[model samples]
Target: MHYVKSKSILSAKNGMNLYRGCTHGCIYCDSRSKIYNMNHEFEDVEVKENALELLKKELIKRPKAMIGTGAMTDPYIPAEKHLKFVRNSLELIYRYGFGFTCITKSDLVLRDLDLLEKINEKSKVVVQMTLTTADDELCSILEPNVCPTSRRFEVLKMLDEAGIATVVWLCPILPYINDTEENINSILDYCIEANVHGVLCFGMGLTLRDGNREYFYEKLDEHFPGLKARYIKEFGNDYSIPSHDEKRLMEIFKYRTSKAGILNDTNEIMSYLSEFPQKSVQSKLF
Candidate 1:
């Protein structure tokens, strides 16, 4: 891992990525895309030096607090286990009494569940887990290095049962791959079973760009064989790879989440995430 000095700690949208590259080694990782201009290797994690310190300083300066991270890279990458930067960052969020949230594929977040609970109790904390495949072995092929989907569902369920809300990023359903309607319904079923607050899926398809595109095609040749040729024949250089079953899967997602009373659309889910609860406003104000 390497260290770099970042000019700012938060994005315009209130999100922060404490690291540049990821170590989880998700074979289909979009962070590998060259567009992000990550100077270092994909696995060579870049630590934002003094990220917690910067976060503390930023929190002190901000008149209104709404901080989040783990969008580009998993904040709880294995490096976090040793550096404890993410944990310390969460502690600072809790100390400053700001809302906290993160997106992670690792169960490592469980280590900080206690802190998460405290934040949720006092303010807000939402955890987002990506569930692409229900089959464990296939999950190994797609994500490769992260925890299995089952465990992620378990974490989601556990969070919901604990009264802490959760959201699922049901995404990257690679065409000619894991894009079956059955797979979508199964994941949506899990979200319903977990009683999650929402499901964020713009569409039942995958978007491939320059860097991640080549990596994904290569992996396809290795794992599914002949699939890369199919992708080329179908998608060419086009970005979106909508599955043949997109419409059906989306209908299922809508029906399932609607019945479960879970927010199913991207707009709704994002609004829920970005919304600062009136309760927090009232308490923090007076």
Candidate 2:
């Protein structure tokens, strides 16, 4: 882990990434894409040393709106356990009466359940977790360092019980590996059981850019021999790699989420994430 002072903390849309790199070791991380221009090694986590002070300043100036994190990097990475950056930032957001939302693949989020509940009471808190595969064994291979999908499902249920809204990012569906109907159904079952507010899936396949494509193919060679060659043959320098079963699996995704009454529309879910409870702002004003 290393530290660097960032010029700014929050994006135009109020998103803040406390860290620059990652360590969860997910095989298909798009953050590794060359466009982000991450100068350090992907696993070498970069800490924004002045993020908290900067966040507090920005929050004070801005109107009540949802502050998002973990868009480029998961805020709950192992470093958070000791650094307490995420937990501290949550306290700041709560202190300033601002809303909070984050996307993560770790159960370490459970540690700050109290802050999340507190923020929800003041404004709103939406926690989004990525669940790619239903099988814990497959999850271990795909995600590697973090907790499995089953544990993430448990976290979602706990968040729901606390009355905090939750969303699931069911994505990066590897072509032949996890693009099966059964995998989609099993993951959707977990979402329904957890009572998530929505499930966001852009398509049935992962996007591979220059940097990530090389890394993903390397991992494929390590685990699934000859799979890299297969991917190269099937998708030659293509950015969007759609699965052969995209249509069928999407049908299952829509049917299951619709039956469960979960939000399936990406636009609606994003609006929900960015929307602040006006009542919370009004309460603070008066």
Candidate 3:
């Protein structure tokens, strides 16, 4: 881990990433794409040493709104267990009466469950987790470093029971590997069982660009041999690689999620995430 003074903390949309790069070692991470221009090693884990200070200043001046993180990097990376940057940031968010949301794959988030619940009671908090496959064994290979799909399901259930809204990012469904109906049904079952507010699926495919494309192919050669060549033959430099059975798979995704009353529209789900409870803000005036 390394620390560096950052000029700003929050983005124009009120998003922030206390850390840059990652270590989860997901075989297909978009953040690794060269387009981002990250200078350090992907796993070196750059810490924004002054993020909390800047966030506090920004929250003090800005109107009460949702404060988001973990867009480009998981806020609950292993370093967070000791650094407590995310935990401290949560304290600041709660103190200033701001809504909170994040995307992560770590059970470490449970450690901050109290803060999440407190923030939800005062305002709103949404937790988004990425579930690529329902099989823990496949999950171990696809997202080797982070907790498996089962554990993430458990976390989602816990969050729902706590009255905190939850969402699932059912994405990057590797074509031949996890694009089966059985896999999709199993994962959707978890979402329905957990009673998530939404399930974000932009079709049933994954994107691969320069940096991540190379890395993903390397992992394929290492683990699924001959698969790399197959990917090359099937998708030559294509950015969007859709699963062969995307139409059918998407039919099931929409049907099941809609039947369960879960939000399936990307724009609507995003609106829900960004919309802070105006009543909560009004209550603070008195």
lDDT, model 1, position 258: 91
What C-alpha lDDT values do all the predictions have? 0.84, 0.94, 0.94
Which scores higher on TM-score, 1 or 2? 2
What does the lDDT read for residue 35 in candidate 3? 98
Tens-place lDDT per residue, model 1, 1-286, is: 8889878878767788888898776767888888999778899988889777778888887745556787899888888888888888889888888888788888998999999999888788889888999989999988888889999988898888778889889988888778887788789889889988888887988888999999888888889989888889988988888888889888888888898899887887787787765462344554
Number of colliding residue pairs in model 1: 0
Off by over 4 Å in 1: 280-286
Among residues 3 or more apart in sequence or in different chains, the pairs in candidate 1 whose N, CA or C atoms overlap within 3 Å are: none
By summed lDDT, which 10 consecutive residues of candidate 1 come out lowest?
277-286
Rank by lDDT (best first): 3, 2, 1
lDDT for 224 in candidate 1 is 91
Estimate TM-scores for all models: 0.95, 0.97, 0.97
Per-residue C-alpha lDDT of model 2 across residues 162-218, encoded as one tens digit per residue: 999999999989999999999999999999999999999999999999899999999
RMSD of each: 2.3, 2.1, 2.1
- After TM-score superposition, the amount by which residue 106's alpha carbon in candidate 1 deviates from its true location, in angstroms, is 1.0
User: Which ten residues in a row are the worst by lDDT in model 3?
Assistant: 277-286
